[model samples]
Target: MIVEHAVLRVRPGQAAAFETAMAKARPLVTVQQGFLSIEVRPSCDDPEIYLLLIGWDRIESHRDGFRQSPDYPHWRALLHHFYDPMPVVNYYGRSIFHD
Candidate 1:
């Protein structure tokens, strides 16, 4: 599996709205072709930060598939505005030790 990771730095006073929007946005990703799973967690050290992890079948599944899907606009609309400086996403392949 491929893991997509991002550290979302939400703007101050936007956490509650961001979480609500995320709930509405989850379905947009779930219907994608190669989606495996997704998780969003708030940081213990900073309430305005969140960790986003999405599992996909391959890198192309996210880069070419979901990013090009019709639902992407909706996803962007629901969540993108909440970011302060925007997040940088990274991808990881299968674990080195977990096999």
Candidate 2:
């Protein structure tokens, strides 16, 4: 399996709204193929920082699948505005502990 990691830095005072929007957007992703799970955690030290982790069957499942699907535009519209400089996404696979 592959894990998608992204650190989202939301605009000041918009954390609540961002979370709410994320809730609405979650369904769009859940319906996609190869989707295992999605998780978002808020930083303890800074409310604006969010840790996003998504489980996929493979890297292309996200990069070439969901991101290419019609729902992607909707997902982007609902949540992209909240980011200031935007977030960088990275992928990890086959953890050593489990391997």
Counted clashes in each candidate structure: 0, 0
Q: What is the C-alpha lDDT of each candidate?
A: 0.97, 0.97
1-99, model 2: which lDDT tens digit per residue?
899999999999999999999999999999989999999999999999999999999999999999999999999999999998899999999888964
By TM-score, how accurate is candidate 2? 0.97
Determine which window of 10 residues in candidate 2 has minimal summed lDDT: 90-99
Candidate 1 per-residue lDDT over residues 1-99, each given as its tens digit: 999999999999999999999999999999999999999999999999999999999999999999999999999999999998999999999898965
User: What is the alpha-carbon lDDT for the whole of candidate 1?
Assistant: 0.97
Give the TM-score of each candidate: 0.97, 0.97
Clashing pairs in 1: none
* Residue 74, model 2, lDDT: 100
